[model samples]
Target: MSSLLLRHHRPFLAFWFARVFTASGFQMITVAIGWQMYALTGNVLDLGLVGLIEFMPKILFILITGHVADRFDRRKVAALCQGAQGLIALGLLLGSGAGGISREMIFVIAFLLGTARAFEMPTTQALLPNIVPSNLFPAAVAASASAMQAATIVAPALGGLLYALGTHWVYGPAVVLYSCALSLMLSLPARQLPLKQKVSLESLLAGFRFIRSRPAVFGAISMDMCAVLLSGATALLPVFAKDILLTGPWGLGLLRSAPAVGALLMSLWLTRFPIERRVGPVLFTSVAIFGVATIGFGLSTSLWFSLAALVLLGAADMISMVIRSAFVQLQTPDEMRGRVGAVNGLFIGASNQLGDFRAGVSAAWFGTVPAVMIGGVGALVVTGLWIRLFPELAKRDHMHPQPNPQPPSAAA
Candidate 1:
């Protein structure tokens, strides 16, 4: 452990462990969901609908959720959300044990899970700055990202293995893990913020207005949204696992873990040697590499080749993610963290869910390979377009927070 992580940051360490348990369980559930749904329907579009069902509540309730995080105790809110997710997992366990799990039941559960995530993500993100010193915040973000990648790397394999035993096995451990996460979240030191005196439409929309006013923040987030929205391939992993690569559930597990494996490596590297110069160009270059790697994965028939491509894809994305996360959180004021995080969460939710929908529809219309390949091309093109559209983002030279160059009035 880095001395930075171990010393003077016991609360942050607890938070990181909470992330591990929560993220591990979530990733495990993801594998179970994708495999079970595909097995039940064997339809690509159905897989896409999985993401859509989960995304709906997130999109609809995001703004309110952000306000709730800001107005209330973020730790308590996160604990409640984590507890709800645990109950949902328990529901899945019971359903699987009864052998009564249906496609509709799965979709309903996914929606409930998405609702929990909607409240949890923004609150959890906003809570970090309160947990660590400002000088160490960037390092904390890197460590946090690394921790998440570690969970991603481990959880899928565990999920796949347990799923191979039985569906109930997957949810059982998930329920336990989520319970642990809730406990850890509750143990974190409470953060006290001034309560909002009044609630109004304008207050709810402050995060939106703030993000819109910050060009660098807006550009980074927009670029990420477009690139990932176009090239998200995780939702379609089952298609590749069973049909394209002819690998079984275990292969699916390895495939899912490969990207995170690369990401974990990159995150650790960043913690040791942070990106200090040409931050904007690094972001753009990393995204472009992500596009090319996606194309490579789309074209590969061999499992090894696909895994290699995915590793590159994940490594590139980690760079982009670290930079973007640090930029958004470091720049935003403490009171506005929840709202800003909500906006960031919305972009992420859109890219992930809508991206899956696009891939499913495209796979249905053209073909899997063509759909993925075309999306990769779109990602590359978006990278170029974003460079042109957000010149200030490209000109940005460092990750440290900078004074706003333009007045709030200049926002359109």
Candidate 2:
């Protein structure tokens, strides 16, 4: 532990630790929600609906959150959001305990949670560069991703155990975890970026225009958006586990986590040997592999086979994650990091939620196997088209430093 701290800032380390715990506790809530809803309703569509509700508010508010992160003291913003999330969880616990928890209430709670996440995520992303030097950004992103997936690997299983005990019980630990996250977030030095101008709708539009101007950033973000939106396999896991795989809730936990296990391994490797060049090709190939793996998972009947497929899918997904995040963070100017990160939250974060909705609706209408398999093939096709459309992304061979933060020309 001491040796690892030698390599990074203490604040960054605390941030990562907080994320691991928060993510794990959050996973518990995720697993508990899915398991509890399914147990009560026994409908796969209901499972998908939960994710849909959870992400909708996030999709709506994330850009504003990103703009806010760019404009203010980020640590305070993070603390406030985490505190909101913790309180929300506590409210959920009480509602569930009342024996009158309806589906509408759950959806409302999910939307509230998403609203909290909209602010929390961009702040977290923007805070990274401030904590670590620019060059260490790649390693830090990879490490942070690994830590997140690592939490995913453990939390779902623990969540399964807690669900087995009782649904209401899961929130208890979650509140504790969120409290810890709040404490860590508060502990960070109050840091704010030197702003070029006050934020406005015009400035927000400029950020979108900036992304449009950069082919690499556009390509990377687009590829990620399409891949997740098309091939959202996790949203279909309840059906896969219960109907296709013939495993119980335990199986659901394992199936959901299989990809994260692979993601964890891949993230570790990326930390050791970061992607240096030809990132476009790396991202394209990774999405292709993700497609193939998702298709294979859709076809598999055996539990272990499906798990293996998801693991492969996860591994491929990690390649995309590292390259895209690195491209976004490394290429963007610091002054625009929060807003750019928020725009990223839009495609990356919103696409994920939208994908969940897509998966849920498609699985409900078309049946599970075809939904996943078709989505996988669509991902494959989209990747091919994107490669041709964004030649700069494919041809770029080197990264360059952005213009440094310049001092004001003169005092007013």
Candidate 3:
């Protein structure tokens, strides 16, 4: 299994390590931002705004970023983005050290960081296919997902501990990690595709057109987007940690890490026993399970119970994430990968950041518990609706790219 996953793939391994370091640092920064923002404002809505601030750049420049990723060297783009993120971390560190860091300053830093991410996400995603053999793509995806989950598992706990010391402590190490990721990215073999002769509005929008013409890709991305948008409980974790469960920063770390722990375990399992059939049903079932787990998490006041629910949620989400990633990467043509990835990133950014914003506003309108519970119910409703609306997705039996059963006209 190990050989199948990582044998003779040094560049891929480097990419994986880069992911680990980058993800860990980013996760640490995330924890510090959340805790410090909540500390400063004592407002749950501010926590949600953190995501919103980060998301705005992606909304603004994702298309251009994706086009750049396709037109230039993806590795260099990623390296440049990593360097930008490292600078942002340094900025955060300096601001924290200078004392009296304002909420607005934090928001500004978040926007800059999000800007770096907007470029980094599509470039990094598009680089994956270029790094490894086509036949080993699934294994590579599984391994990459596992590495990310592992980072998520460790980073939050580490960040929480570092945050307990000082917010600057979190930023300082994050700077180092981001620098390391930049170095690794710089070292990767360059694979720049030839640029198109002419740029047009149609070329820029081709990814959208492709997805619209392929129901499976459309269904998968839309389902994950809606489910996650409704069910996401991550943004409200600090509220639960401080007010509901009364766990404190340390407890918040554990709460944040719980889902990743489950995800890591599931990713490891998938690496060993790759899902070969009925992938659509697996995706739907996992999402439904994720919704149920979110409901349980929303209702739980106890730390242990909440952790269990989050773990289940993570496990289920892992399945959907792996399947969806494979679908997007495998199904799309290489020339269009970056643009498609950008669109996918947009969906992800909207779901995660906007979901946090939604949670925050809802928590402000209703109580925290009610907001989370309602979101969970909304996820369940989305799952049912998606299944009914996109029955072909449920019938999708394999992960490998296949001929579309529906004609383009029917898909539209």
What does candidate 3's lDDT look like per residue over 229-252, in tens digits?
887878899999999998778888
* Model 1 worst lDDT run, 10 consecutive residues: 190-199
Candidate numbers, best lDDT first, in rank order: 1, 3, 2
Pairs of residues at least 3 apart in sequence or in different chains that clash in candidate 2: none
- Minimum summed lDDT over a 10-residue window in model 3 is located at 1-10
- 316-380, model 1: which lDDT tens digit per residue? 99898888887787778888888888889999898888889888888888889998999899999
- Estimated TM-score per prediction? 0.96, 0.92, 0.95
Model 1 spans with C-alpha error above 4 angstroms: 401-412
Give the Cα lDDT of each candidate: 0.89, 0.80, 0.88
Deviation (Å) of 32 in candidate 2 = 1.2
lDDT of 2 at 130: 83
Q: Per model, state how many residue pairs clash.
A: 0, 0, 0
Candidate 1 accuracy as lDDT: 0.89
> For this target, which candidate reaches the highest lDDT against the unseen true structure?
1
Worst 10 residues of 2 by lDDT: 1-10
Which residue segments of model 3 deviate by more than 4 Å? Answer: 4-7, 401-412
Candidate 3 residue pairs that clash: none
In model 2, where do residues sit more than 4 Å from their true spots? 1-8, 399-412
